[model samples]
Target: MTDPETFIRSTTRMLPVPGVPEIAVYTADEATALWEKTEEQLGQTGLPPPFWAFPWAGGQALARYILAHPQIVQGRTVLDLAAGSGLVAIAAAKAGAAAVWANDIDPFARTAIAVNAAANGVAVGLLPGDIVGTAGTWDVVLAGDISYERDMATRLTGWLESLARDGAEVLVGDPGRSYLARDRLELVASYDVPVPRALEDADSKRSSVWRFRAA
Candidate 1:
């Protein structure tokens, strides 16, 4: 298998995120093609899609909100969970976060985050594993587009709730994914986030940012 960075550079183009023009990340031209290409490159089958190659709607929305409202993360330590492409993590750093960590379970995603963060001229620490059930001292925790699956969403929400209770401000950005725990969150902001037609049902997703309520 080729070095992940080399494969990512060959397969994607650095592009500015929609709505958030201050930052850019490596993005694939098409999701399905990239998914297949990733598998072929790794000599693997049934691998997850290359999600780190695109700026998802929820991430874009969250990035826009953070850039617009820099006060949210300014001078605070932040963690971007499932930090695909490091989009939101870059936003936090650009918004003046004291320190930012981009956390993702995928090794490919960790490499992609490092690449994208360097491209965007921000220093971000890459956390390469599942830290969901663990406690951290981040002043702010950001999650984007994470509620797409039933069981995963349930587990994540539980962890996020615990984070909130521990005094970390937890925020979520989502496009009405079926499992989003609205009952445990309060709306902070909303936007019509631009999305790739190949990846979403529509060209734009009405995404919302929510603050997890400590329960």
Candidate 2:
């Protein structure tokens, strides 16, 4: 197996994210080339898309919110669900969270999180594999760009709502993804998140940070 961390570092450049410049990430300049490289080197035909290779609109919005409102995570435990590239997790840790956990089932994503967190000079705990139905040990649960897929969104919404019922502040960063259940959430913040044109319809998206309310 290819050393995912090493491969990521070699294939990508450490670029400062557009809105969140406090941290840097190893990102592919072009998505197609990266995808082809992954296939050629890894020989893995059926792998999850490399969500870690770029800063998504939702994650960027969430990170900006956390930086602007540090008190939300200060001295608290934060879990960034489906933590692609560890952007929001790093932001929470930077904003003074007592502990920040970045969770992603993909091996590449986990490796990317570790590398990105280290690059940002933050200590983010790694949650390997799925933690969808786990205990509500986190003071804040953040999900960014997770509602793009149907099956995962179904599981995610139910689990996040459970955490909300347990009194943990649950926030979801979304860019009007097809699967987001808007009725279950209330908006807390919105941002015009800059994103790659290939990944979004426009140069930026009007993403929002939505709080999950009790049922």
Per-residue lDDT tens digits of candidate 2, residues 75-153? 9999999998999999999999999999999778899999999988999999887888888799999889999989989
lDDT of 1 by residue, 1-215 (tens): 89999999999999999868889899999999899988998888999878899999999999999999999999999999999899999999999999999999988999999999999899999888889999789999999999999998999999999999999999999999999999999999999988999888789999999999876
Q: How accurate locally is residue 107 in candidate 2, as Cα lDDT from 0 to 100?
A: 79
Displacement of the residue 73 alpha carbon in candidate 1, Å: 0.8
Q: How many backbone clashes does candidate 1 have?
A: 0
Q: Rate the local accuracy (lDDT) of all candidates.
A: 0.93, 0.91
TM-score of each model, paired residue for residue:
0.98, 0.97
lDDT of 2 at 31: 82
- Clash count for candidate 2 is 0
Q: lDDT score, residue 121, model 2?
A: 91
C-alpha-based local distance difference test score of model 2 = 0.91
Model 1 pairs whose backbones collide? none
